[model samples]
Target: MTILFRLGTAREAFDVSMTRVRGGTGTTGPPPPGRRPERRGHLRRIRADRVLLLVAAPALAYFLFFHYGALFGNVLAFQDYVPFLGVSGSQWVGLAHFERMVTDPLFWNAVKNTLLIAALQLVFFFPAPLALALLLNSIVGDTVRRFVQSVVYLPHFLSWVIVVALFQQVLGGAGVVNGWLSTLGLGGISVIGNPDAYGPLVIAQLIWKECGWATIIFLAALSQVDEQQYEAAALDGAGYWRRLWHVTLPAIRPVIVLLLVLRLGEFLSIGFEQFFLQRPSVGPETGEVLETFVYYTGFANGDFGYAAAVGLFKGVIGVVLIYAANKVAHRLGEQGVYKA
Candidate 1:
């Protein structure tokens, strides 16, 4: 009887300990109260948001099918790709296309032109939006501010073709400016077909068309700035310029840094249509960029493999630039396009 009682006590103790650990029966029971409801809540939320998920399905599918799927074609960079033979039967030339690209004078010229144009844009075009945003944000009247925004943003909606045509009408050799110059007994200056002025002209066109649209982002950032900060600066006897330097700029600095980092990533991809349409006017020496170079090489010269190599090289450079820029942003204590 004593032995049986001891064994029963030991068994009971074991069962109690096991139940405590399991929060119920020894083997299992329902999950702990907190976890089961939390899990159920998560599943419930997912079910509730099924409609939104359904709405997003098409866009997700498009990106998966088109953008991500197209990444597989990068293999053409290694192969001497032929359309007739397709990817499977193409002869692999390894790095031969890349080797040729490195030694090609035309390729180097395109790089030079691309860098020069990109530099011009970074220096001149990049700051225009910020300046305009500041000017717009200073407006005391909402009506005037909104009207100005609409006028500036209207250009962004215009197609590149329409925008280019409008610029030609205003600034081309035989256009409005030249017409006025001729009436004043002055020589009509070359702008449209002038290779020397092409860089500046491209920058001008970019600013006119896109500067206002870019300003929208800056303005949005500025809107988020605390009005109290500006008021405090004013109470401290800080003037407009001083307040702008100290308060306004600091508030939007993060946005500026983020945009700058993103711009660096896309530094080489200065639009195909813009350069292509203008290339004939300025000639390849002035206007050939990586985009046009790729197009001409692949479609015009039918050198698909070499073009793919150039494109792949460009993509690698972009990745490096974005990574470096993001690192710099993190070092400066700013969140860039992504966290470090």
Candidate 2:
């Protein structure tokens, strides 16, 4: 009887210890007051965010139906696609379209122009926003900075047609710049339709339209930088340029690198509307890009299969570029578009 009582006491002690460890009575109980169980907490969060999810539903549906659904059309790249025959009746040509694309001189020309424009954009246009952001950040007064920002950002909202017209009015042979030059007895310079100047003109237009918008991102990044770092650098006898080089640039280097990687991923897509509108002025030799090339090949010539093949190739290249860039980002110890 004594041994049985001892064993019963030990069993009771063990149950009490377990109850304490579990922060409950016996084996289980309701969670402590003001605290929710894990599953309940997750459900509560989902309920709280339902409004936001509802608001985003339309956009999500549009992408699902339009963007992702259109991916199925890529099979046309491998077939001799005929509108009358439909996808189901289309003759499968295997790699014929791809083989033709590989040997096409026009496609190579488009590629060359695309690469040239992309390089120019990387060298000149990419740095404009950063420089502008730095200038805006240096302003001491909030009112002045905001006013300047508003003025610069206005162009971004203008349509590409309006922007192109504005450029023509400002820089065309008979426009303001030429009229001023003619009054000064100087020869009027041709810029709008000049083949040699087409690349620079497009880059200039892009800078005017988008540079300010891009600056907003850099400015936001700059705002997150602690002012104390700049003050400390100044105290160490570092001048304006030195502080910028050591502190400001380093603070935003990650954003710059991230943008660069993203930029490279879309290197071949140098805007369709801009190039299509300007192509007539400079001719196809100078103005043709992959976007325009695809449009002309597909819609204009009704060679859908060839165009689809070219588009598929471009997409594959973009994917490769993104993967390579993300890998480089990981190597540099930065979080890229996605986690390593």
Candidate 3:
């Protein structure tokens, strides 16, 4: 009560002093605008940081030339896009392709597969990295931890083609597992090419390849948690799980929510390379995703306009999902990927 009273009294004194100063200066409103000098100062700072700006030039150019530059090509979505005619020359038939997309059964199938894979990933793959990070954090030996991290992180550097082939060699119908089972007079189980097992298989592959790399962020967050808090919790007779639940998780909750929001933004983009490679084996019915659907429709079927419409639609949904997820994160008192 005393602390609150003192703070209130100090605030009142400051406000009164400010009002007197303003009245004496004959200023009845806010102070004069400082924006012009602020802008000059900002420009001067940028000029001083010219070398640093030079270093960022390549990345700035890459985004400008690729991402923002490509945005103009979304104009193809509303046009009957033709390679020979080009974007400006193409006939503009607004929303026709969008209507076609709504009526297209194949497009709906792709949507279904994309959502299923995304849900599977959210449920199974999302937490795998956090769990692995916790397990790795519990390890006492530096040598063992470094070795395990190196081994796990190596897969993330490998291309999707190599990863898929590695999985096939180990888990496919005629692979090591089936071969061993056959030798033991046990029946072999089909896995790689099976549509029914596609969801679980893809989830497994994603976990194996990306889980370790994903742990990097969580590990960094864990490193920032104060050791004193853990010690205090332990002194209070809290067990490992109890301490983790109370202290560790709260410290890292912001990082987790940030990653979750970012992940939700790209929820439907479950990767084209992996699904495209496996699509032939599992058949399009089970493996088609938005990216691959866009690829096949535009390149294979020569429906460039329709494909662009689908791509634009996907991009819009991604933006909306990110915005909604960020809002939810804000409501839950997390900063998420962006500020409200």
lDDT of candidate 3 over 11-48, digit per residue (tens): 34345555554566456667566534344576787986
Residue lDDT tens for model 1, 69-159: 7788899999999999999999999999989988999999999999999899889988999999999988999899889999998987787
What residue pairs are clashing in model 3? Answer: none
Q: How many residue pairs clash in each candidate?
A: 0, 0, 0
Candidate 2 local lDDT, 61-145, one digit each (tens): 9999998877888999999999999889999999999899888999999999999998998899889999999999999999999
For model 2, give the 10-residue run with minimal summed lDDT.
1-10
Model 1 residue 158 distance off true place after TM-score fit, in angstroms = 1.2
Off by over 4 Å in 1: 1-60, 327-340
Measured over all alpha carbons after superposition, the RMSD of each candidate to the real structure, in angstroms, is 15.8, 15.1, 10.5
Local error of candidate 2 at 3, Å? 79
Instruction: State each model's CA lDDT, in order.
Output: 0.82, 0.82, 0.83
Residue 299 lDDT in candidate 1: 96
